[model samples]
Target: MRRIVQFSTGNVGRHSLRAVIGRPDLELVGVHASSPAKIGRDAAELCDWSEPTGVIATDDIDALIGLRPDCVVYTALAETRPMEALEQLTQILAAGINVVGTSFVWLAAPRYAGDWVREPLEKACAAGGSSLYINGVDPGYSGDTLVHTALSLATRVDSITVQEIFDYANYDDAEYTGAAMGFGVAEDEELPPLFLPGVVESMWGGPVRALADGLGIVLDEVRQRTERWFTPERIDCTMMTVLPGQMAAVRFAAEGVLDGEPVITVEHVNRLTAAAAPGWIFPPDGHVGVHRVVIEGDPRVEINTHVSHPLLDPTDAACISTAARVVNAIEWVCNAPNGIIAVEDIPQAAIMNGLMWRAK
Candidate 1:
């Protein structure tokens, strides 16, 4: 069995830990946390598992490395300054531990990642003879994989559009909800332009451009546009009112062009308030959110509107599901050629297996 260590105890990390615990092919060797309160707690207890495992959380990187696990799953906060985390990843790689991560969006497009981050991580991985892969649901799965899945049905393609629409009211954290929907007004805001446009473009842009290039289209430019909506009065979700006139909704639309004509467009919409547009509904079906992917093609086709379960929170599901997919691909990514890779480059069998394993 491959021994694995998890690097966070947050939502996505916990979900991944659960998945890892249940996988017979893998063993949960250790866990690391930045929080002092969690340092000595049992991993299972920290994740609220019914029983405690002997695996204890530690803040000491050296101690964790001493365990010599085969791999480390890094699912830390995305907005946190990535330099330290990247350095940590480099250390893990240099220790000869394969790294599968949900951070580092530019791993999907190494060329887009500036020198400071990518070069060091690459060197570390090469020097250590280790492999590194970064992936997740929004930027990783939904944007790239979903678009690629849509393209499978096309006989002749002109453009591809993938969209995600969901209710953000269920999220309690103002900063998280704001970042999800692209609201950047406060100085303390973690919801920066990166999540809004730069990062999103970096993650999905390569896939969209790749699809265009695959179709023999010479791409010219990529453009981004954002929209924010607010309500004049406060409104309550099932739990509480978010905030009056405080970023009720936001959307980021990115388009890739070939010689100034649109070839691909990916749009992400997060709504915290009630619907102002026709056919857009909040808590539709008494749920926190809904995700729909629509693809426009020569003949035009669409597949699966994955709606959030009322029993399950959408944001949490999205985050967890994305992480699960990434983790499932660890072995494939390890064996694949290096540099930068998108979901499209992964084999269909592996992708299907990842989805099936997640479902099971």
Candidate 2:
């Protein structure tokens, strides 16, 4: 069994911790929590498990590194703290431990993440002979993994689009929903970081570039577009409140253009509530989150993936899926050669383990 260190105890991190503790092939070694209350608590308490696993959460990175886990499942909030997260990942890599997590959003496609983000991780990995694999539901599977998987059936490919249609009100992060996503903002206010120029390219462009690379096509440019819808009535979610006339829904896309045509595109349609954006796209269920991949070619392929959980909301259930994307890849990441290992590097057979059989 590979020893694992779970980083952070946020929405995604909590699920990662549970996956590590529940899996028979994985041993929970250490947990890194940023919150003061969670730092000294048992891992079970953080994830709602009734029994303790003899593992406690700590904020000391050095202490966790000293544990020498085979891999660290990093689910920290990277969207707001990209540089800090990257630095921590490098530190973990330099300590000679493999890392598989959802923190590094841009690292999902390193070539487009720019040198500032890629160089440090490369140096650290080479220095300590460690490896890092970053993946998530949208940037991880929906965009690159699932999109590519569906493209396999296309005889002639024209354009590819991956859309994440979800209600963000269910996502329980006030700062993320308010500041980062620009939800509940006035019409005259400035655009939020997510919609600002170059931000979309920096975050979602990874999949666009990866798709371009996979198709053996060089994109002339990666462009971004965003639009918002205002809520006519006040609405409240688990995290923040959206007042009347505040921005409630957003539709944005990172497009890979070749000869002025968008060949590969990543689009996101998010609403504070399902009722906010009736005109925009929604899943067949028309209730929660769904990732749709559409390929326009001779034999067009369109797949809508609806992720759910018995005890969790659709937004949180997607987090569990995101954690699984990286957690399940721990073994492959640990066994691979040291460096920033991409999804293409890991074989499908190795990554598909545990899905067919349930462990008692």
Candidate 3:
């Protein structure tokens, strides 16, 4: 069993912790926490296990490094502290420990991260002969691996579009929803950072390029289009209320153009509820969130995937999938050549270990 330390138990990190505990081949050697209150707690307690696992959580980075685990599953938030995450990953790699992380998401394809982030990371990897693999749901499997795998069935390809359609009424992170994504705000106000020009392309374009490269096509240009819908009447939501004429939903599309046409495209359709936009795509019955890939070719293929459990709804399943995508790849990543790697280079992510599904 490979010794592993989990970092920052957040939305995705918590599930990563669960995955580490569930996998018999991975041993939990340490748990790194940013919160002072979380220090001195048992890893099993942090994960809500009925009994202790002998490994206690700590705030000391040196303590974790001292253990010298084979790999570090760094699931810290990149959107908030990208520089810090980069520095931490660099330090971890320089210590000769391979990494599988959800941070620095653009590192899902390292080259697209520009020279600044990639340069230091590559230096650290080379210095220690350690490799790093970054991934998540949308940026990880939905757009890159899932699309590329589905494309294999097509004899001739016209275009490929990967879509994420969800009703986010139950999604509680008001700060992230309103401030970062510009949801429930006045449409006339300046759009949030995510909707601003070049932001989505900067963050998500790497996956598009990764998928395009799989098809051996070079995108001449990458473009973005955004459209928003407004609420007609005040509606109460678990997170926030959508008042009359307020921002209700948004559609954002990033297209990779080749020969003056979009060959690879990724679209996100998020609604406050089904009523927000009746015309827009919503998950079929028995699902609330759907990650879909559509290939228009000789043998057209459209794959809709939804992760669900008895206790977890579609939204929770989405978060778990994000964590599980990279968590399940830790072994393959640690065994790969020393460098920054992508999903296409790694083995298939096997996530069917403990979760059961409802087939309809």
Candidate 4:
């Protein structure tokens, strides 16, 4: 079993914490939380378990580094704190812990990560002989990995389009929905950070690049397309609300062009409510979220994936899937060569232990 330290217990990290405790192949050495109230709490209590884990949460970053576990699941908020997150990742990598998580979005495809961000991590990896892999549900398992896996059956490929169509009603993060993505803004308001120039390319473009690289297609350029919608009436969700004429939904496509055509693309149809975007795709079961991949070629194909559980909504279920993606990849990443790695660089990433077995 590999010794591990979890960096945060936020939206994604909370699920990661549960996964670590249940994963028999991993031993939780320490857990780091930023909130003062969370400090000194038992890891078991933090995850809602009855049993007590001796591990006590700490606010001290230096103390986490001191534990020196074999791996660190750095699921702290990166988009909200890129510079600080980068600095923290740099310190952790330099300390030689094999790191994996969704903190560094661009590391999903390090080749596209800007030098200012990628260079320091690369240098740290070289100096410490460590490896880092960064990915999550949207740009991760459901987008890039799913597309890559679906392409194996294609005889010839022309265009690959991956889409995430989901209602944000259950995702109760007002700051993320209203401010970050402009889910509840006035119709006359300017584009929010979610649609701001370069943000899409910076975040979703890595998946496009990864798909193109997998298919051996050289993209001539990358482009963005966006459409915004306002609610016809007041829209109420689990934690937030959007008044009439507010930005209720946004559909944006990030495309990677090859020979004047978009060969690889990632599109998001995000909304405050399911009824907000009728023209966009939706799963038959009407789950809160669904990720779709369309491959146009000799054998035309379309596939949709919905990940959820009895106790979790589609939003939290998606988070759990994202956590499982990284947790399951822990062993492969730790054993990999010192550098940044992506999903394609590793094997099938089957769940560890005897959770799933094949018949001889």
Top candidate by TM-score: 2
What is the lDDT ranking, best to worst?
A: 2, 4, 3, 1
**Better candidate number, 1 or 4, judged by lDDT:** 4
Per-residue C-alpha lDDT of model 1 across residues 1-360, encoded as one tens digit per residue:
778898887767887777676666678999998888988988887766676778999988888888998778888765546778877888888887887878776666454556777889878877877877777765566666666677777787766776676666565445444554544243334555544547566656755665566667777887776665655556666324545545556677668887677767767767654542223434335555545455666668675445344556777677668677667876676666543445656785774443334323
**Which candidate do you rate higher for lDDT, 1 or 3?**
3
Clashes (backbone N, CA, C under 3 Å), per candidate, total: 0, 0, 0, 0
Q: Which candidate model has the greater TM-score, 2 or 4?
A: 2
Error of 3 at 251 (Å): 1.6
Error of 2 at 336 (Å): 0.4
How does each model score on lDDT? 0.68, 0.86, 0.81, 0.82
Is 2 or 3 the stronger prediction by TM-score?
Answer: 2
By descending TM-score, how would the candidates be arranged?
A: 2, 4, 3, 1
Cα RMSD, each candidate: 3.6, 1.5, 3.2, 2.8
TM-score of model 1 (CA atoms): 0.85
Which portions of model 2 miss their true places by more than 4 Å?
355-360
TM-score of each: 0.85, 0.96, 0.92, 0.94
Residue 302 of model 4 has an lDDT of 82
Worst 10-residue lDDT window for candidate 1 reads: 275-284
lDDT of 3 by residue, 210-328 (tens): 77777788889888888888888887876588888888888888899999988888998988767887787788774678899999998999998888878765676788888877777
Comparing 3 with 4 on TM-score, the higher-scoring candidate is 4
